[model samples]
Target chain A: METILAQLLNGLDKGGAYALIALGLTLVFGTLGVVNFAHGALFMLGAFCAVAFRQFITYETVTLDPTKLSPWGAPLEIKTPMAQIWFGDFGAVLINWSVPISILLAIPVMLVIGIAMERGLIKHFYKRAHMDQILVTFGLAIVLQEVVKAIFGANPISQPMPVELRGSADIGAMLGLTPGMVTYPIWRLIYFLFSASIIGAVFAFLRLTTFGMVVRAGMADRETVGILGINIDRRFTIMFGLAAVVAGLAGVMYTPLVPPNYHLGMDFLVLSFVVVVVGGMGSLPGAVAAGFLLGILQSFASMTEIKAIIPGIDQIIIYLVAVVILLVRPRGLLGRRGVMET
Target chain B: MNIFYLPRRDAITLAVFALVVLTMPIWLVPFGAAYPGLMQKFAIFAIFAVGYNVLFGLTGYLSFGHAAFLGVGSYTAVWTFKLMTMNVIPAMIFAVIVSGLFALAIGFVSLRRSGIYFSILTLAFAQMCYNLAYSVLTPITNGETALQLTINDPRVLDLMFSERGAGLPSPSLLGQGMSGIEAFYVVAVVLLIAFYIAQKIFVSPFGMMLRAIKSNQTRMHYTGFNTRPYALTAFVISGMYAGLAGSLLAATDPLAGAERMQWTASGEVVLMTILGGVGTLIGPVIGAWLIKYFENIFSGFNDAMLHHTFSWLPQGAQDVVVAITSKFVGEGWQLSLGLIFVLVVVFLPGGVMEGIRRFSSIFRNRREPGPTGALKTSPAE
Candidate 1:
């Protein structure tokens, strides 16, 4: 029973990340009616942003000692700003902060990238067929992934957790059980909490705010929104940006869970796309619910007992769920009627 | 006079195409020096693209998961080798039939939705198949992490299998060992025939209905024509073509992997169709050939090739040229593909074939100036 509980907790952590990313994806896909294939790339960029900032912050310079200096060692070198802040007191004390700070930086950067992508590439696709939009966005994704690879190389870049939170917390000990059992990483717990918070905030903003209300109205009927003089295009573009930032922020927080890589975006893109579909194209809450449900289901499928019975069950779980759901409920669990329907 | 001029241009074009296909080995001999393996790859992909074009170009439904059918065909062919004999033709036929059935199932379900929903449904199914192939279906897929031939595989249909590993007598010509390149040429010829048949179908009455449905399905349905059958026919035909291409790929390499059905692979076919000029009969083949050429040949040009080529130039100039060209080659090859796709979509939406037609018109018109321009102007004029 405890083991099951443990697995469930772990599943929730993973589900949280999946839900966050899917929520963002569904927002753009649902509202703007543009399948932004670059959403994953934006997420990757966000994670990479964390890595980049950390790399910058941890950039260090070594001063050569006359007695034991290497043949090629410089006498003295000035470090960058990040190094100065993170590596103070002549390397005696090192402060390699957690990924959260970099994630904070990613929001604005992602928003900017989202807006730029919307204005530059995706805007032209609105009038085109979904096929064209998919093609162009796919091309854009390739460009984005390639650009990252060219700049950062294909190697997976690690984003280390803070020294203080390096190891897992003993939940077992806390619960009057044996020590060192039921261990969960602090960073992962924080990620889950953070994702839930973001998801809540997005939902709150949409449910409560006038901008979101107008966007929802726009989603139902673009012409109606336009007739009301809401500047639907600009709003849609901003929504694209918001979606990008959401995906990016998810990526940033997720760096501690899964190291940021160029192809990470591609990996997440398909599953998130499935989530978007299963959640119903334009339903925000639906996306969140489906993402978590699928994530947990997938996690359960990876159990040893389940694997013993069914080979590759873990890999195909989400897809099987998707197929069944699609056949049963073509519009998804909460999809808005007539949105991208035949 | 009408008899003498009865679409002489179409006949001439057909003859020229046939002639080029017949003499490919001779014309492409020089290219073998630079790219030994590419021409064959070009032909194989051309078959796949042509098959994709049948559904996408004529029917106007853009399938994002066409590669799933192709992969299905390839896997079926490879399994036929393992279960039955090494005779490629039987395997190819089985592949087409199996993939056709698979397509029928998927299309029946997915075609219920139109536009983006349909595309997404197909995509989801393809992804599902890919995931299953990669993990659970590994036993049937040879259990090899990467698709490859193995010696220990059971040949249930091998009548001559011996515990002593005895040599059997030589088989007939059809079952005899043929080199990979010879096999490729055979497939290429078959593809050319398929392309020609597709051209005929495009101009046929059935083809007209498909196009009509694409323009407006509601109107066609209201007019009392069953649009479902036409669309389903297009889907099945395209699926079979993809399957045939897949079987050829397996026959050529004798292995199949799930990667063939990746969304990216599906996207590649779509890009090929769009880049070559959607709705144009020969455009897909041209597009596929171009992409395969770049993917296989251009990417293989390395820094060493660059350094050798620019050896005569001054140091700085040579470095600059090498740097610029390096982007088109090496790990950055996908950049070129992406750039081409974006450029073609944004600037020349009609695609490469359209670009070629326009360019040809310029030269053809320059030869005979105003009177012919007026005389040859299409109906839109």
Candidate 2:
């Protein structure tokens, strides 16, 4: 029973990440009909943003002291608040808190990147066939991955969690169950809450706002939306940026969990795509449900008992789920008619 | 003689082309660097590309999962080798039949959708296959490590034991797999001829119907022609060709891995089809050669090689030049490929074949007087 609960939590966290990325992809695809293959790259860029911000906050210039015994010592230093809290033991207060500071820094940077990508590359591809658009975006994704690799090098960067959220919380103890085996990471819980809030906010914005209505209208019928005296193109472009922001923010929060790498995008891209497909293509709610569902399935598939029967079932669970879902419902779980039909 | 009147010109060009291909390995014998193994790789990929062209180029159906068929073919051939005698012919035949069956099942469902959805469905299926082969079907696929014969395993047809040794001898016709430049040359020549025959099929009446279906399926449906069978036939035929290529791959390498069915591998064939010029006979072959060239030769370059070659230049100049050129080769080859895709889609939609045709047309136009006079004074006329 405890094992099952633990697996369920794991599933939720994994599903949260999947939903975030798939939500972003579906948003762009839904609003613009442009299959943004670079959506994964955008998420990758967000994690890189965190890495860059972390580097900046902790940056120190060393000067060679020829006149003194100590060589390669920094003459002056500045420290961040969290840095002091975390690295007070080493007497390096300022830069020690880089990870927490990176969150604030990731948002604006990711937003700007989202806007730039939408305006610069994706804008040109909106009018082409979905395949052509997919090709271009896929190309853009390769370019982005290569560029990131060139800048960061082909290595996974380690990120220490915030000092406050460093340890595991004994949920089993709280429940008065066994003393161990059900400890959950505080950071993971925080990540799930953060994702849920973002998802809720996005849904609210789309449901209650006028801009959301216009975007929904655009998604329904671009020709009719245009005929109604609205520049649906500009709106769609903004939606693309909005989608990128969601994916980027997901990456930012996710960095602490997985520690981002250049090729990480490709690793998640396939699974996220399956999530999108299984969720009923353009349906936002469906994407979330599918993400969590597949995540749980994946968790269950990784059980020792399951592995004994069928090795590598965990790796193939989501794909098999996607194939089954697609065969049964060609339009997907919540997919409307005429979406993927011939 | 007028160019339009010279249908025989194509035949002559084909014969010359066949001669040149057949003679290439012999010519390369003096160089010794261009081995038969490399030539065989080129032929195998070319065959795969040609099969891809059947569904994509002729029928306007861009399948993003053709590599799955290739994988199926390879696995089937390897299993056949394990079960039956090490006859290359039978393996190739089994590959085709098995791959055809697989395609029939996949195509029946996937073909329900068209355009981007169709591409995605195929891609999704391929990814599923890749994942399954890597994990769930590890007993059959042999997992990340390729399947190989064990000493205890029975050879069903041969009634002989593979000598209990550290490593088993390669399964091939007579004894060992094809060796030296001569074997590769033979394979390449055979494939080239087969490609030519396939090309003839592309221009045949049946090929024309496939083209018609591509242009307007609904019209054909209304006209009482069962378009489904035609499409299915094309899919099966292409799958068979892919299987043949896969069997050849197994024949040469003697192992099948899940990586062969990757989405990127499927995408590579699509890139080849588009790059070479879709619907044209020679395009896929040319595209295959170009991509394989990039994959092998271009990616082989490293920073050390670059530094050594440009040592005489000033450090900054060398760095700048190397940085720019490296995208075309080395680790950044995919970037170059992506750029090529963008440029091709945006500008030369007809691909490399179209460019070659245009270049040839200019020369032909210069030599001929005018269309009216040229036709009136045709050699036949």
Q: What's the TM-score of every candidate structure?
A: 0.88, 0.86
Q: Tell me the tens digit of each residue's lDDT in model 2 across B157-215.
A: 66555444455545566654565664576467658756866766676777888887777
Q: How much is B334 displaced in model 2, in angstroms? A: 2.1
- What TM-score is obtained for chain B in each of the predicted models? 0.87, 0.87
Clashing pairs in 1: none
Name the lDDT of candidate 1. 0.77
lDDT of 1 by residue, B210-326 (tens): 777777788788899988888888899899999998988887777788889998999899888888988777788779877886777677799889999999999999999998888
lDDT of 1 by residue, A1-342 (tens): 566656776877778877878888888877777777777888889889888887766766555455654556755443444556554554322335647777678988988999998888777777766666777788888888888887788999877777787778787788888777678888887877888999989888777999989888887788988998779888888888888888888898888778788989988887887887788887888888988888778878899999999878888788778767777787788887866545
Worst 10 residues of 1 chain B by lDDT: B372-381
Residue A200, model 1, lDDT: 89
Winning model by DockQ? 1
